[model samples]
Target: MSLTSAPGPGWLLFSFGMGLVSGSKCPHTCLCQTPEVICTGKQLAAYPPDIPLNTRRLYLDNNRITYLPAMNLGLLSDLVYLDCQNNLIREVMDYTFVGVFKLIYLDLSSNNLTLISPYSFSVLSNLVQLNISNNPHLSSLHKYTFANTSSLRYLDLRNTGLQILDHAAFHHLITLKTLYLSGNPWNCNCSLLDFSIYLIVSHLDQPGEGLTGS
Candidate 1:
């Protein structure tokens, strides 16, 4: 008898084949698979693409994404790494990073962002390294932007096009050791003289490399 004559078995086989084909054609906007989660260069303009539930690493680089959705990112609970570089993101809305508590490293460089909202990174307590460099238009950071990020050690703000820093910009970052501000246009005037004095006194008390001017 021909395979088609076995109706029950043949129907089962056809359904299985269709499922396999569908699984093979995963959408270009997301890679919902094992081992690695690669979503780079997707050109996505929408928020929350269909990421895998078990995803550990996420790469959302080289897209046209301009804003993060207001909904909390609590679904990707297993995520450990995230890369959102080279996008057109201009502003980070409040509470935009909720539930991403396990992230260790974050890169938000090369974007059109002009400001970091106060308390923007407060909930990322486990974050160890952060890179926000090369954003030439970023000129200001709210006083409490890094207030609760106690575990942050390395902060990169190089070439950020800053002309002034408020006295409390780096407040509460007591654990911070290496700060990269090499290329910012820091204005060292009377308004900043107190902060400069504090740094000098603190540096002399600890006897380390001292501060420099523009």
Candidate 2:
């Protein structure tokens, strides 16, 4: 049986954004509020430029955006919530989110992602929830892909088409809970031995708790 659990960047150029966002109105015809930017369904093809440094929440869902260029959102130091679901993103490059260390919630579901660089999210120290579900083309996760999100609590990987997980894939996720791994075709063999052993040792296999394939 496959394992399932539920329970569950860079600075610089940032100095320049501080000036552009100080008193700027929303750029690219997007909505702007005190600490949130609403750009959902605007049909944007790229990450909005000149975001306010004080923004705490950003919504970029249901758009045609294909790439999240490095430093695209790195200037928003105060950012804590981000939503980029249903886009055309094909890959997650390293340091793509360099300086938003305070981000606590993020969603990248329903994209066309095929690969995510290891350590892509190594800087998120306060992250608690993340969703990358529905990316059917993303079949593998390099070890250390989630290197530093020790505070993560909820993770949703539903419908991701993943077949195996590295035993050490989650070795550093000491606080993880509410893991959703349904809708995957897991190969239950020696490849899963370590992951399965981890589940048992972590108490994530306490009967009726994991792997409900779709």
Candidate 3:
């Protein structure tokens, strides 16, 4: 099925080696520049197939996408940014981002996702920012969830209904610069004592009063 509905604009840029071009194919109900394709609020049910191959930025927020098949988004291998927040996505399967090796920013917030396969982000070696906040159903983050994202600098897990944080969940994120854990019903008792201590010792700063339910 076609993944386009109408055209709209948002602020983001995606430039490649050849510089910006004109007349590049843009999905119906979308706007395309040499490096960016914006299609927000299109009520899209699936990914658009007609977007230019060289696109570096893509916006598909406020849609009805429920699942992201592995490598389906790999078509945009050069993508550096993606925004799919406020959708119905329920799970992040393994290798879902394997092809987007250059992706630097990703936003999958406000979805229905309940599970995140540990290997789902293994291939995003260059990713710097990741947002998975507002997923009320996502309650736990496995210790190895971020084992491969050594370059990740920012992580957002706010309002995810998290009650338990695996002690080693943030172990591999040595380069993480900022983290968001507010709005979670964190049981700051014994279970989180070590994790909390680790955060303090590691100097990983949280936005504000990140954990609650002590």
TM-score of each: 0.75, 0.86, 0.85
Off by over 4 Å in 2: 1-23, 205-209, 212-214
Give the distance in Å from residue 108's predicted Cα in candidate 3 to where it truly belongs: 0.6
lDDT of 2 at 75: 66
Candidate number with greatest TM-score: 2
> Global CA lDDT of candidate 1, please?
0.67
Supply candidate 2's per-residue lDDT for 129. Answer: 93
Clashes of each: 0, 8, 2
lDDT of 2 by residue, 1-214 (tens): 0112100011465545554655355666688897999999999999887677788999999999999865557667788999999999998876677768899999999999999888777778799999999999988898887777899888888888888888687888888877877787787777777887787677542223365442
lDDT of each candidate versus the true structure: 0.67, 0.79, 0.79
lDDT of 3 by residue, 35-109 (tens): 988889988897765668788998989999888754346556789999999999999977577557899999999
Name the runs in model 3 displaced over 4 angstroms.
1-24
Q: What residue pairs are clashing in model 1?
A: none
